[model samples]
Target: MTQAMSCNEAAGLVRSQGAVVLHTSPTTYDRYVSGPGMCLLDQTTEPAWVRTADSTQCFVGYRCRAIELEIGQ
Candidate 1:
């Protein structure tokens, strides 16, 4: 987060910090987190999106927040 890193680095960080990463298109991003263990890190404002490098119709959201992944009891 404080420095540049690859996807693997980010994934490792997520695993270390007990989190889950969800990649989705504009239509599916918000809807995909409905299940338990998934929470929007910040709900006070609308999430932001960053376009993919290929210029494809895909983007990453919630990158700046701490999304928590909980486990089922």
Candidate 2:
């Protein structure tokens, strides 16, 4: 299931998932394209095996089920 997460939490999740995390923002025309275009903002800060597409415009991680996320109020 998907959930709304803060930037900090997203970073932590990326680290634990053994996935490469990147921060990105689209260029002027890139933002208006039918498909989104992403500009890399930062390089990977942690070790991960996930390969990100060049179009990636946000920091995201991926990995097998190891650590579970705790949800609360």
Among all candidates shown, the one with the greatest TM-score: 1
Off by over 4 Å in 1: 20-73
Q: Which of the numbered candidates is closest to the native, going by highest lDDT?
A: 1
TM-scores vs. true structure, each candidate: 0.27, 0.24
The C-alpha stretches of model 2 lying farther than 4 A from their native spots are 1-3, 20-73
TM-score, prediction 1:
0.27
User: Would you list the clashing residue pairs of candidate 1?
Assistant: none
Q: Which 10 consecutive positions of candidate 2 have the poorest summed lDDT?
A: 28-37
